[model samples]
Target: MAYEFTKEDLKEIEKLKTKYPEVTPVTLPALWIAQNRFGHVNPEVQKLVAKTLDLPEAHVHGVATFYTQYYKEEKGKHVLDVCTCLSCQLCGGYDILNYLEDKLGIKKGETTDDGMFTLNEVECLGACGYAPMLQVTNDKYVNHLTEEKVDNLIESLKNGEQPEYEKIGMPRRNNIK
Candidate 1:
């Protein structure tokens, strides 16, 4: 089936567009809407976004590729982006990452067989003080991680529980007036 935005998604896009003088500035929000609705911003989704924004496909694709937050292909329900920056590294971030890999039985950048989790070793999540942190689906950050905590997190996620996390840094500006 051909990809298309839902009515509500279109409405949200329109609402977001109102914040900008022209559609070009709406690219990020539009791509975000597509990713949130469809999971990942695939080529087809990029094309649709390009069409919606009246921009070239390459332009949309470039914008999506420029940001690590935008997944270009299908990802698991939960994506764990572990911080491997200097601060996190000093705090044993790699150990936590390796532990996750061993526990999940999937290497970094690969999804589990059941498609529940995907692991990624990402750059700084801006939680230098917290260190050893991971972000789940841009929703929350798991900070001051321990192996036991990682185990519990995996189990909780496997059980469909929204585990509470100790957020690390200041909130990102996702909503612009």
Candidate 2:
């Protein structure tokens, strides 16, 4: 409880502790909140969480690094994740990723000079039909891309134009369809 966390955060931590009788049960959620606040897991955060829970920093680091969702460094506002799964590769995901790199002048795991975009290669995004896809933020996944399409997608994103994704999967509902 003597961590560098804010007052509100401490309250939330107290609630979590109340909910979970064990310290280990609260580790993942606490790490997620800490990372959201700091943009990444750092040595300071690991130590703070570990000491607060009477755990080891190395254990905390192991959990943080094991998950791809936990970023290790500061990321750009928009994360461009290119699919590199087998389906996507067969459909030219590699070329699409190369195009993104060349266009942004940054390789995979690198951010743009303007801090607007970060390029990364990820596993299947569940859009195999739209293989060779790139996800911008959590919204857009421009698929079946050509060079012109990629350029257009980037420009539209820069212009704050949110494209509609039709002809793909539907959102799940509790009730039957």
Candidate 3:
């Protein structure tokens, strides 16, 4: 597949290159743009980026695999990533993951058949206060999640509604009134 950069993407990539001085310096941003544009960093993109920056395909793949944020394979519209660090695990993280697995009928690292959602488990999302948190797309749902809440969140997305983040079972910050 031949992947051509969009006009806007080219402009942004040029800006990134000017700011970074070296093409390697903008590797992350460039990879992000490619992922956002093509939904995944297919082999075609790897080749194009390598050619653009005069780097090798192996080098480009190295950076892409290093970051967990980038997806190499095609993903559904929504990606649900559960935090499975020690903190989250200790705070009902397993149950939360189990619930999502059961609810979505998909195992970890798998996408649903309907092509609406993908379920994955990742390391800490830096929201330890909300131990059992999960990120859907760009938004994070904090606290120990219950099946009902997860179902509600999924339904809301199905209905084309953005889920509002409201603290539920997670510990609150201090200095509150």
lDDT of each: 0.92, 0.81, 0.82
lDDT of 3 by residue, 37-152 (tens): 98888777877777777778898999988888888888988888898899999987778888989988999999999989898998988888777878886465645677787888
Model 2 poorest ten-residue lDDT run: 1-10
Over 4 Å off, model 1: 165-177
Q: In model 3, what is the error at residue 32, expressed in angstroms?
A: 0.6
Ranking of predictions according to TM-score: 1, 3, 2
Which has the greatest TM-score? Answer: 1
Q: What is the lDDT of residue 140 in candidate 2?
A: 76
For model 2, the superposed segments whose C-alpha errors exceed 4 Å read 1-3, 137-149, 156-167, 170-177
User: After TM-score superposition, what is the CA distance of residue 135 in candidate 1 from its true location, in Å?
Assistant: 0.5
The TM-score, computed over Cα atoms with residue i paired to residue i, of candidate 2 is 0.75
Model 1: weakest 10-residue lDDT segment is 163-172
Error of 3 at 71 (Å): 0.3
Residue 163's C-alpha lDDT in candidate 1? Answer: 73
How close to the true structure is residue 175 of candidate 3, measured as C-alpha lDDT?
A: 92
